[model samples]
Target chain A: MPTFNKYVQIEDKPSMVPAGLEKAITAAAAKDTRIIAVLEDMGFPGMLWFKKNCPERMIECGIAEQNAAVMAAGLAAEGFIPIINSFLFADVGRAYNQIRQSILVDRFNVKFIGREGAWGEPGISHNTIEGIGSTRPLPNLVILNPADAVEAEKAAEAMLQYVGPVLLRQESSPPPIKIFSDDLPFDIGKAFSLKEGRDATIIATGYMLTEAVRALDILEKDGLNVGLLDMCTIKPLDDKAIIKAAEKTGAIVTAENGTVIGGLGDGVAAVLAENLPTPIVKIGIEDEFSQSGKMSPKDELKEHFGLRPEDIAVSVKECISKKEKLRKKRK
Target chain B: MAHHEKLVKDLEKKANQIRRDCFEIFGSTQMGHAGGTMSIIELITALYFHHMKFDPKNVDWPERDRLVLSKAHCCEAIYAALVELGVYPRKTLGTYYCFGSPFQGHADRWCTPGIDYSGGSLGQGLSFAIGMALAEKMKSVVKDVNIGQGGFLQRYVVRFDPLYRSYCILGDGECHEGMIWEAAMFAAKYKLDNLIAIIDYNKFSLDGPTNEIMNVEPLVEKWKSFGWWVTEVDGHDIRQILDALELASKLYGDYRPKCIIAHTIKGHGIPAWEREHIHLGRGAVIMKGIEEGRKKYADV
Candidate 1:
């Protein structure tokens, strides 16, 4: 399959805790009776912390996602904090309509914590690469896809107080351990620039942030100073990030753990296409269904879709070089 | 009960009036549903004028009962009934289907003051009604809790946890929707006795007749399997409809949510409104407009 030499190991069978999420969950649920986790009573301490604080507040309506969505709506109507959890398949498959009608339409303060993406060896139906794009443009649905554990915790704390429907997508594999602190407050509709460059801007959200950082380093080795942006929030995207990234780099390359169509990559490209018209390349899955092989084929699947870090670095370099040539021609 | 009798007696005339109102509303839009609205008038008449416990003055009274209209396209009948009950100015009927009016040829919860849930999507209203009923029951007062005496109910004056009933109205066409079965099975499982779901079993749907599309024959058997107290009535007959509903309300100890299938013909009240293509938006063959909408109503 596809191999990332640095880290490529599954959690013995299926242990549900995807790294840094445990830490973030512990911190976010530290104080708040209104917030509780609805995950199965597995070894995940994050769930344990939630049950400890908000015993009555944390609603567990079984493993049924549809019931969770409906009960969340009921709780929201009655002024209760409701958080629902599951893998991509359960949330998007059964509870899609329920989430649309009851949760989103009612504008309930409900939290849908699930893995954001169509990545890794999660199989075909489990590969929710198109999940974010499909859920976008749903009127008041606010989707925030955090890159790592710290961002996830910050987003969770911020969304807990926000009075709207939030589709919080967390990475199945935590990238950076501590990207932020209690000091750098996480807000909605905002993006952060990690590094400044003059060649190309690489905008990435969710687990793709790690790849964007790596791609930038690869470009730096090639004497190209590439810009990097962490697009934590997908819907109500950080337009300022796109404009700033474009003004500084002149060309852009976008990436996310979702389909290239309506994912963060498109969100970035759509902005540049309209405002700046920059030479941009998107690194994500093309329009195709993921394979349903026996083993989890995350890397192989990503490679098949041309989402490798090398592919991203090469595309950004090529785009920036092409833009430079076009400028020269214009001159 | 006495009011119910009067409604049953005047049912035929009122049914015609409602049918006329439906046609009139449709006429205003030049293109709107006719068959379903015509069939639902009598049941609507019985529910609003007689059955449902609500005051026109206090629309959102805490304890006031509510109706979940699953078939929203028959909004004309609902609007007409609301107006007839003095819940709002009858003048609102004139604005039916008018540009930018609250009346959008469908039951808009915002526009129509008492519509509990906006029901554009079919088969979803019953679930919402269940939530409301659950809220009402859960929010009731338990003033004093004595370990030996149980939770005491304080008999007070204002803000009485008004014993509200949830009436969910469904269409025969809606029976084909899979979600309706889910709602029915859910009602049966929960034993939600306070929920009264009435189905307007008008055989004719938008495309010809329902039998041709999806024959839900032996409908009562289906509901019985779903663990419901099924009651069948001639949809146009007010006495039968009222009697069945009264039987349902008075039923004690049986916690199964009741289902009243009012077997009806689409466009039942109005003769012209139901025949062939005329009722199915085949050009305003008749000035089925409310002013002229009166004649098409075959009340008796």
Candidate 2:
């Protein structure tokens, strides 16, 4: 019903604390002594803010991600909350068994923060253009793929209060803010409606959430209302919202910076296929390792992965047109 | 003191009986790790029935001390000790590897009730012990447990809510896992002198001798390099295992963990099981003819 009109230059780049991740961490740390952080030693001066602010709470376990995961498991088992931070690929590949046996098997309430999911050519090393599929089978894990810094911060804060294991994937670079603060805290297991429409529901996570929101604008201009939901919590999903959207909308497009098979798209499909079958299109990195790109290739890579807002806009328009034809045939 | 000596002597007799019991159990199973079980009997007996502070009546008492059999194939010895110590019923020893038995070949933490951790995987027990020890310190309840009834709602809170010291029986072969080295480094870093890791250095491994398979020779020097107060002893010698453990407890300095390399023969009791190359995937290596290997020597 209402839109924030602080509209500025509207550029693509965003600030590091775009959504309030820093603020949330600061506030959360002040209240809980169990919060300890193992920062990656990749020389990101950005975390110098956290380390300097909470010297007693922050412990860097050197470059050993495997050891860090076990250390976190040990701390969690002993009633301390530890966040082992690294990129998604390294954390998953290096410490799969540790997470499987020590963390998941014990059901220890530890937190894993994978800072970047699929950032194309931040260096191919940083790109997990195909990441999320590998994570779906880990039992009892709650997966959160936040769209922007604000959502990331809120999710991070909400998770510490939870009594089970949680993982939050963060974007190395911030994206456009699609959902402004309701001035109220967001709870886990609920999806936020970025835009309300009836044409088709587009589900997205990671950097693609903002793109989905922008694509909905293009649909709205064409007099076709589109539904947009930021599916932040992928596991123990907001099934009610997804099923309701599918029942009303009849078509969907899911996008993520992860693999197409098991990211946000598959999660939505599993729910819809069981409840209300619908035509769905998915966009993400295919099964291929990312190649080297320009030093500043964010824009180019975003387009390459069909993650640009304009690409989403086109997909949305084509789906609506196809649906209109099919409806006519039904008539 | 004479009475204590008599109890120790009685315990030795019980150990010999347990050796026989283990043989029967292994024989019935038609397949079991006999050599290891026979080797660690006295060590298990001394720790469970005599030294370690535990409550058989209240097994999960938070304050009670913990003993992890890292060399868990010798679980027959642990099970035998637990049965004698009254944690498990004596009848269960007969069902060692029997169908639907709570006991299995190697101790499974999920399956075995009294064992703190299931450690057949090797090298993992040290890490688990480190966590337990750290938790005990953090809880700040520094006392061992005493035997008691489930009554008395306002008991002494057991003087301790977790163990002040933790004992682990590690297999010399389990030292092959690199994770052990990492755990050692961690122990050193945290000044975990309260955590005593004892290597069940029986000279034999499954295939043959550990030294020939992969030398753990100069084991003390290896531990010393990892910043531990290393002690070597005859594993089968109750006095030596006890003295080395006591000496290790007293050697206090920051960043020096304790590692006791207790050496013992693989099959110290049964002659055939001692150094014989029993073929792989075959049963009853120590045949009926050579029960002389079953002779008990006054090695102590």
Candidate 3:
């Protein structure tokens, strides 16, 4: 079972976001004619489908990402919702200033579907973990990183429906098992609580949620009650849910597939430090570039980076111990 | 005088007025990009007064032609145009570069009225113009196709005939950025005939001469190789600038974008301002140049 929660019906099959984005965008395009696809040679699953369906709506911008970014801003200014898809490094990293000055300055309604993760053959050049950190500081830009196929689809739909600039980080990683049920209630900037816990809460995003769910089972078998909070929307972060989690669990362990420096870990830590102070352990790529990792039989990068379910369980215990030590010191 | 002669005379007078307005703006702020701003005055004046289809009464007109001032540091010229066109009061010129003012240091579409694209970064405006051109082409294309009884389909049949043209003004020194060529190739590939670009070949950047700083030499050939219809015009001459822009606007169905290399002095008017390599000036120095420019315009 992928998820031990009663509300979530885990599908037996594994899936990725490129497929989910394809389904979500194509469906969204059918209804809204304003949607346009601006690609940077990295055709992510939906390019061919979009070309076949709406030929004129899909633009092939070639390998020029900077031009593509400003072009999307122009299209957005004209009231057409332009979606630029590429690796996060090329889409955000290469065109950082273009996206900042041209798009985010006036807050254009541009959707960027950036793909990147640690577990891939593309190596460090393509898989940049700094995207979440770099983009989080930009004003008027919303960031979303979905955990499962269902959430990806739902997030894409929500992203399209919303106005202004948004970046949906589609992870290029091993397929995640379906976690959310069909009738999952998804909202922008809101966190979904799978289960409540008394010992510690696991706050995860993107591909790390699958490992988090598995960690929940491991902790349960060891006679521990751990909660899981799916923080899909990284920007405009769900603060109430985080405070509630910290209040209930008194300890938090953050997990993500990207670097923890400016990613979800730091975001959660900032929130907890300000609102409700809680002992926390961050589980992610610790201040390093991602290299080539095997993905077939075993995700070697996950093991190498200490992001496995067992690693998360250990971090949870460490966080709980920190909380206990703090209580003892207060006495 | 002939009708074209009268039109030329009117544009020349408008250009002179805009030059004075630029001086007024510089005098108020005591800081401005004087050299490049003076060089592009005739081009801006002609576009606002004669060429572009903009309504000063309604700045946000849907079908109005767009202008992407890519060399946006010299937005003082555009601000002068807005003042002359009655979009803003003359008092607003005093607020230029202030803490809270619509007339910002650079072209900002949100802050300033009649500005199409927010720009300060060079080599970015051409791509934005292409986008606006593409959008205009899309809108002028097949809105809906009807095939006999009860057969209505929405097809994006990209018709090249766009109702409104999109123009971008670039600086010669700004061509050093590689993204300019990237946008140029994309425009040629897509055959955006509705787009027109003008390069203010003023030869000087902030540091020194453009060729000495980093040459964008053989500039016309570079654009031509990127598949653009290149034209050369004496940028200071109002008649020649209008003629080039007119030819570019009328060259429809050519399946190529147009570029006009406007060779101009760094500061076109006022011999004192033209003599100095003053890309930007502040306080007493800029105030001195504006005074000299006012004296020269009055004498003319």
Name the candidate that leads on DockQ. Answer: 3
Q: Tens digits of per-residue lDDT for model 3 on B1-300?
A: 123988999888888888888998888878889999999999999899988999999988998999999999999999999999999999998888898799999999988878999999888999999999878766655544322231112332444446778999999998999999999998887777889999999999988899999989899899999999999999999888988988897786676899999998887776656778678888877877877888878744
- The TM-score obtained by model 3 is 0.95
lDDT of 3: 0.87
lDDT: the better of candidates 1 and 3:
3
Summing lDDT over every window of 10 consecutive residues in candidate 1 chain A, give the lowest-scoring window. Answer: A1-10
lDDT of 2 by residue, B105-224 (tens): 777655677776555655666766765554444444333322123111111122212245767788877888776776776666555666788888887776677889888777888889
C-alpha TM-scores of all predictions: 0.81, 0.80, 0.95
C-alpha lDDT (0 to 100) for residue A148 of candidate 2: 59
Against the reference, the lDDT scores of all candidates come to 0.66, 0.66, 0.87
**How much is the lDDT of residue A296 in candidate 1?**
38
Off by over 4 Å in 3: A1-7, A44-46, B1-3, B143-161
Q: Compose the digit string of candidate 2's lDDT tens values, residues A12-96.
A: 4553432466677667877876776655564442243466556555544445565556656655655778776677766655666
Write candidate 3's Cα lDDT for A10-100 as tens digits.
6647967777788899999988889998878765452656776776677778889999999989888999999988888888889999999
The regions of model 2 sitting more than 4 angstroms off are A1-22, A38-60, A120-122, A129-131, A173-178, A182-185, A294-298, A317-331, B1-40, B68-83, B88-113, B118-122, B136-163, B203-218, B252-255, B265-300
Query: What is the per-residue lDDT of model 1 for residues B1-300, given as tens digits with 9 covering 90 to 100?
Result: 444555566876776666655555666656666677767788888887777887788877766777878788777788877777777675676787777776766686655677655666665666556645444434443332221221111211223223767788887777887656656654554455667888888777767677778898778999988888989999887888888888887773366678899988876644555565233453554454333455444444
User: On a 0 to 1 TM-score scale, where does candidate 2 land against the true structure?
Assistant: 0.80
